[model samples]
Target: MPARYFTLEEANALLPELEPVMAELLARRAKVVRQRHKIAPILDDPHGDMGGAAATEMALDFVRITELVEQVQAFGCLLKDLNTGLLDFLSERDGREVYLCWRYGEPRIEYYHELHTGFTGRQRY
Candidate 1:
C-alpha cells in the first residue's frame, strides 16, 4: 500500500490525537512495570509456600505483562519516530514546499519529495 503523507499543518493537527495515545501507552507501560515489581516479591520469596498452581498463575501473568509491555514499546517507538522523523518545513530539491509525513500505521518517514508529493511519491509497502 502507498503510504499517506501529511502536510505540516495536517501533522501538527494530529499532535493532539497522537499525544494522548502516546501518553496513555507510556502510562500503561509504567503500570506494567509496577505490577511486575509488586508480583516479584511473591515470586521471589524463597520460603513462601506459593504452590505450583499459584506459581504457574504468576508466571502466566508475568508473560502476559511482558507481551503487553512489548506491544506498548513498539507503539512508543512509532510515536517517537513520527515526532523526530522530519523537519517542520522541508524544501524539496525542486524548491517546492514539502513537509515530513507521518500517517497512522506508517513505520517511518520514507520521503519528503515535494509539497505535491501526496501519496504519489510515498514509498509502497
Candidate 2:
C-alpha cells in the first residue's frame, strides 16, 4: 500500500481517538503479562493443561489485544509498543518519509525519526 503521510496537525488531531485505544491496548497487554506470570508454573509442565480459567482469560486477552491492535492500524498508523503506548504516524518532512512519534501521555505529537532510526533517534517535531 502507498504510505499514508500525515502532516503534524493531522497526526496531533488523531490523539483524542488514538489515546483511548492505546490506553486500552496497554491495559490488555498488562493483563496478558500478569496472567502469563500466574500460569508460568503450569505452562512449564511438559504435559500440563492450562486450567480452564487461566486458559479462558488468556484466550480473551489475546482476542482483545488483536482487536485493539486492528483499531489502531485502521488509523493508518504503526503501533510501536503496547506497554509504553508508542505510536508512529507515517509522515513526510524535508522531502523524505519519517515517523511522527507519540507516546501515551504526551500532550501532542512532538517527536519524529527517520524510518531506519527507530525511537532512539527521535528528533523534535
Candidate 3:
C-alpha cells in the first residue's frame, strides 16, 4: 500500500504534536533508569534480605521497566524516521517555482503537484 503523505504545512504542524510524545518517551526512559538504580542497591546489599517477596517485587518492577523502555525506544525511532523522511521543498521542472511535499510514508510526492515552491504544493499525496 502507498504510504500516507502530509503536506509541508501539515508536517510542520505535526511537530508540535510529536514534541510532546518524544518528551514523554524520554521521561519514561529516565524513570526506568532511576528505578533500575534503586533496585540495584537493594540487590547488592549483603546484610539485607534479598531473596524473599521483596526480591520478587523488584524483579517484576524490572520487567515492567524493561518493557516500557523498549516501547519508548521504538517510539523515538519512529519519530526520527518520520522527521527524516519528510521533504521540505522541491524545485519544479520550470525552475520558476517550487513544490512542497511530505513523503513520511507515501509511495511518492510526484502525484502532488504544487503551484509555487515550498509548502504551497497541491495536496495530491
Candidate 4:
C-alpha cells in the first residue's frame, strides 16, 4: 500500500483512538515480558518442557500484541517506542516528508522530524 500522509489536524484527531490502542499494546507487551521471565528459568534447563498453561498465555499475548500493532499501522501511524509510548504520523511539511511525533501523556502532537531523523531530531511543530 502507498504511504498515507496526514495533515496536522488529521493527525491530532487520531490521538483519541491511538491512545487506547497504545495503552493495550503496552499492557500486552508487559505481560509478554513477564511471561517470558517466568518461563526463562524453565527453558534454561534444556530438558524442560514448557508447561501448557504458560505456553498458552504467551501465545495469546503475542496474538493480541500483533492485532494491536496492526490496528496502529492501519491508521497509518508508526508505534516507535512502546516503552516510551512514542507514535509518529507521516506528513508533509514545507514540501518534505516528516514524522509528526507524539508521546503518551503529551497533550497533543507538537513535534516533527525528517523521515530519517527519528526522535532525537524532532523539532516543535
Candidate 5:
C-alpha cells in the first residue's frame, strides 16, 4: 500500500483509538518479557521442553503483538519501536516527505523528523 500522509489534526484525531492499542501492545510485551524470564533457565537446558506452558503463553503473546502492530499499521502509521510504542505518520514538510512522530503516553502529536532520521531526530513542528 502507498503511504498515507496525515495532517496534524488527522493524526491527532486517531489518538483516542491509537492509545488503547498501544497500551494493549505494551502490556502484552511485558507479559512476553516476564514469561521469557520465567522460562530462561529451561531454555538453556538442551533437552528441556522449554517449560511448555510458559512457552506456549509466550508464543501466544507474540502472535497478539503482531496483531496489535498490524492494527496500528492499518491506521496508516508506521510502528517504529515496539519497546517504546513509537509511531510515525507520513506527511509532507517544506515540499519534502517527513514523519510526524508520536510516542505512547503523549497527549498528542507534537513532533516530526526527517525521513533518514528516526526518533532521535525528532523536532518540534
Candidate 6:
C-alpha cells in the first residue's frame, strides 16, 4: 500500500487540479509517441546523426513526461494507464485496502477496485 490514503472528499477535491495536469500529460504523451515514431527508423543506427532537433525534442518530451509523472505522484495518486488516463488513490473500502479509481473525463471518483484488479474490476463506490 502507498504511504498516503485519501478520503472520498479529499480525492474529489483534487479533481479540479488534476484535470489540467491530465490534459497536458495526455497531449505531451501523444507528442512523444509521434516523435518516437519519427525517430524509430534511425534509433538502431549507432552512426546515424541523432544529435538533430528531433532527438533533442524527444529527450525533452521524456523529461517533461517524468516531471508530469512526479507531479501526479506528489498528489498521492498512482497513474495506472496513460492511454486511458486512469488514476488510483489508496483508500480503505469496507474493511480492506482498495484503489479509488478515476478515469479521464469523469466528473469525479465514482468507482474503486481491489489491488489485484484493474479497470474491468472497478465497482461503484
> Which candidate wins on TM-score?
5
Model 3 ranges with Cα > 4 A deviation: 43-77, 81-125
Model 1: lDDT of residue 52: 57
> Against the true structure, what is each candidate's TM-score?
0.39, 0.92, 0.36, 0.91, 0.93, 0.90
| lDDT, candidate 1, at 95 | 45
lDDT by residue (1-125, candidate 6, tens digit) is 43798888899999999999998899999998887877987776889886478889889988998898889888999999999899999999888989999998999999999999988999999
TM-score, predicted candidate 6 vs. hidden true structure: 0.90
lDDT, residue 38, model 4:
86
For residues 39-86, write the lDDT of model 5, one tens digit per residue: 999889999996788888888889999999999989999999989999
After aligning candidate 4 to the native by TM-score, how far in Å is the CA of 55 from where it should be? Answer: 1.6
The lDDT for every candidate, in the order shown, is 0.46, 0.91, 0.47, 0.90, 0.93, 0.90
Worst 10 residues of 1 by lDDT: 76-85
> What is the full ranking by TM-score, best candidate first?
5, 2, 4, 6, 1, 3
Residues 1-125, model 3: lDDT tens digits? 33343444554555454444445444544555666676677678897776466567656755764564455343322222222343334333444333444444443344445544334445554
Candidate number with the higher lDDT (2 or 3): 2
By lDDT, who's the top model here?
A: 5
Model 4: per-residue Cα lDDT over 6-94, one tens digit each: 99999999999988998989888888888898887876776778546787878988999999989988999988998878999999999
Task: At residue 30, give the lDDT of candidate 6.
Answer: 92
Evaluated at residue 54, the lDDT of candidate 3 is 56
Give the clash count for each candidate: 0, 0, 4, 0, 0, 0
Off by over 4 Å in 1: 44-77, 81-125
Misplaced by over 4 Å in model 5 are 46-49
Q: Higher TM-score: candidate 1 or 3? A: 1
